[model samples]
Target: MRQMPPENPFDDDKLKEECGVFGVVGVADAANFIALGLHALQHRGQEAGGIVTYDPEAGFNSARRFGYVRDNFTSQKVMETLPGEVGIGHVRYSTAGSKGATAIRDVQPFFGEFSMGGAAIAHNGNITNAEALKRELIDRGSIFQSSSDSECIIHLMARSLQRNIPERMKDALRRVEGAFSVVAMTRTKLIGVRDPRGVRPLVLGKVGEKGYALSSETCALDIIGAEFVREIEPGEMVVISNGVVESFHPFERTASRFCIFEHVYFSRPDSILGGRSVYETRRQIGVELAREAPVDADLVCPVPDSGTPAAIGFSHESGIPYGMGIIRNQYMGRTFIEPSEQIRNMGVRLKLNVNRALIRGKRIILVDDSVVRGTTSQKIKDMLLDAGAAEVHFRIASPPTMWPCFYGVDTPDRDKLLAANMTVDEMCAHLDVDSLQFITLDGLYRAAGVPEGRDANAPKYCDACFSGEYPVVPSDMIAKGFEMKTAAE
Candidate 1:
């Protein structure tokens, strides 16, 4: 489980959604299995969740529940409530949602009337060109109920060709900029698409006979007893129908630079990624961290669940004992839900407590994936110091998150990032640590390499969040965001 931020001041080290999408076809109870897959993928998004299932006898049935999957869509009774053999699921993080119209309308599985009947689509990535596309659609008299970028694709599909939904989706997809791993349902076809850069995860799986599952991670496949197959390629679309699956990458293929963050902090340990095990990848990062920056510390401690892999690797490499310094109380549902001001403070305190027996009088090297705002790390350092650690040295397995991620990650605005504004020395001083080391960008790429920088002909990454080099620029670059009130908005 990941630690959340406080109500005000954005004081918590919250990592946003990396976007999770799932699809299933051909299983006996595929609709229910899709729900199970969604439960496994709930970690990807906590804001809005939904499932669109189809029934051969009746029709497409959808059950949408907002909030955590456990609280919103738990119970076999609920699973049985949905009907269908083929289905698609989405857990989302909102970007443009507003109180009046955007939030409600944007809850996905956007359905539209089209030439080839109708289709329901759910998406997990942001489109840099959404504003432009929305403007174009509105100008052409297309009405929109949702403000989500996901809905843009639905409208585009609606205004597209009659031959096939998949082809129409591919045609529309070719025009959109940024990351997307889309799953759509139609009367006769189920479609899946991944953007050219492969910034998000979308993998293929099979349950038994005539059944397949597509998801952002393998954990869902495990839940539904679906065997892991392969990843949907960058610039590719796959369609399922009549016990057959076909793929088309009409757009030119590009290099795959699977988002490095997936292995660093987003994905579950049990999931396999990009030819390597997630746990293995995180552990290897620790091994590399030790080789690059090693220290003679008494104990190697992980931040919590996210840092466990690197801690083990650090311990193995340093020949130092590994100990669970911070014990995370998995039972804490939401840190923000702590009732009162005092309880909120206590809730943060109660979430994790330093293991006194292991840290007392020991020089500790604290290993974590990355630090967003320095507040949480500083507090943890103070906590460890209070627990009697002789000294604290912080080691980050992934490169410092120097930039915000706009594609799907819930990164704060530029000024909020610690690494972007402060020097390494300044950051260490701010966190009040004896020393600190971050994995280099080159090292990150070397560990989880991406395609060569934008070749003139190939599709590229929207590193705007990382490098401030967004693929598509806003028409109103000077305008305020959704958070701004009427005057600014």
Candidate 2:
């Protein structure tokens, strides 16, 4: 029997991207390419991985595992099982699914055999209205095999009267609400779709003369030697068959409200978005943060790994020396064992250790991408103080995350977020820091290449966590007495 990995007691106070999806058509050993792409996207999700392939002889084949892509999809013995020239894959960190005995069943590349032909789908992002849809479908006699929000699409497609898989998929999407970027495969075609708001990302790429690929980020394409063609636009769907590609727009047009956090945290530094380098954008964010909130400190330090690039920019802009005061353990997977009371009190020593020699008797400015729950920040502060640092100040790269995200990111509810209920002064007190400041919302817009600033009437991106302005209405939450906060509020 498969069991879930132990939860880490030393979890960081950061939001997590839910999943990554990839697909390829007209390629030999398509599952191999899908594996490579999923490996590149491993940073997005690491709990579980799956691949589904279609062949004329075998019809459809699927393999799902409860671990990293590199561990599960690398072996020649495993790759040989999925023989096809068309396939789709997914890497998941569960946002919606039962976390019990049936959890592995929820790992996706969900399949459905319609009257026309069978289609397999791998999806990123959450479906807010899934519970309502699931009840309605069950009332109509649809038996769900897994307890996952994504399975609603398969059942919805099974009930569609549309002529083809793409049309059925369109019909299904029209009924669902919230963010989605999907990669799917029918017996004859590979399909990709992004939601109307473009809340999650999907990119198109070309491989040699006869192959095409769809991936959550350009980094996946880079790993497989594929050339990025373009990002799949909001509300756009592409179908690839027999080396030919066709595009369709099924949903009504809306201004693309891409997730701003993609720039602040989610995406890989090597990937490009909207033609801007992600690393450069992050560096600019740090530059903006330094300009907006400078501190009198002897050294600037980063939380390590994710915080490195921004810290470099802060050091450059603030004219402060940058040093590695905190060193992270390289082998620490996000997974952590359940801690006893004594271990829980021990805090960050498991994943990070302070370089006491560099930290002693120095005032330090710490740069991190964002703060979510405040636990990690508090622990880091205590660690720094224990290391004999004279003072510790925090400069965040983004504005206070005052609202919960209902899109692809796995954010805590509003009540759990420290910024949602506290002022900067209150947060500083809570963390027991000398000072705390976040980058202004306008400064973030400037760093994101919109120098004119966020227009109150027509905002360019989804800053829901910062601005409480969600592009897509969260229907399920509304039904549960959750009120949507408009930009004016």
Candidate 3:
């Protein structure tokens, strides 16, 4: 099958979040709850979705489809086949496996059978050492079923000598490196585990009385009417069976370094991370951006959905009026077809249009989350100019994205990241904007709840994309000749 094109091909210049994982145990029609939870997390990944449920008589039943959760999982035809009280689901955009034209085999909630029992897993972060593990495993006679790095976990578990599935899972993860938030299921248990650095997110929640859930964000729990309990700590593993919960530390303890971009982007605005509201944090970022890079303009406009909260905060801090100068077409979807060059050339206009009445003769301050390839920024700026805007000033909510992320985000290579190649002045000139400014790394940390600012000696969050200081070494990329920043540099 030819890989389906992105929803808005011309406007897809932002970094893509890898995946979202969700599981529920002790609920009636658990697949239904899983569907709702995955729907809430659809922002994380939109290429494909899968669900696996275990019933005593039916055994393990799974449905993997290449599309949005609503389009595939909402049908009674698919849900009826997956009847069980325990289920786990995943929504994916393919950061680690095949790129375009995803094969049905690559759709996740990957399952494996072992001597102890059968287990299914849904993983939310990238595994940096996947290639090395795959090479070693293949040499040892492990026949792989898919190209996904997440498949390594199941293979490793199969090789473990542990007598039970949970212990074997611990054994499997112990040998792995890099960021991960995994939700897996065995015959009677729902398991959730995070990487040693907690570079990705995973939260635990409770349903009515005896039910429990594990999800990539609090927003998903809300969809299923599950009460937020707490986050699965860095390196901590939890197994829920029959309404009882068991926690274990599967890896050596280390200082936590959660991904900072979760606050800037990636996560849903309504979700909570580390006890702080994601939307509030984004607004705070705008507040900090205004203080760091003030621009005098008639109106403060956002790039659209992702940039709205930050733009509001910017307006509040800068004492400028916020206006909807650009409106997004909410009905456009991934399945939108561009059958000809004429349609393709319409580009960003299909997704966003400038409000000529609001923008005419106005000096606008455009607040956006980040600048990736600079393509979308250029297009949006041109749209504003064509609408008779006198001046366009760009204020970015996050620091320059100068590096690619290996911890589950799908970022362009270093050469393709505009910030990596061009200075702020050069970027401003290239985009033909009157001015362009990004929030300082320290400002971002402050908005993310670090009041004292980032301590270079012990930074609080994983800001590899901005600081080039990765919490976990990306072994596979390094082996492929990717360079790391030195201390002196």
Winner of 1 and 2 under TM-score: 2
Q: Would you list the C-alpha lDDT of every candidate in the order shown?
A: 0.74, 0.89, 0.92
The residue-level lDDT of candidate 2 at 165 comes to 94
Quick one: best TM-score, which candidate? Answer: 3
In terms of lDDT, model 3 sits at: 0.92
lDDT of 2 by residue, 361-440 (tens): 99999988899999998888899999999999999988999988878777777788899899999999999999999999
Error of 1 at 312 (Å): 0.9
lDDT of 1 by residue, 234-335 (tens): 778889877788988867666754566788878888898877788887887787788778988899999887999989998998899999998987776653
Candidate 2 pairs with clashing backbones? 7-336, 8-336
What TM-score does candidate 2 reach? Answer: 0.96
lDDT of 3 at 203: 98
Worst 10 residues of 3 by lDDT: 1-10
Candidate 3's displacement at residue 70, Å, is 0.8
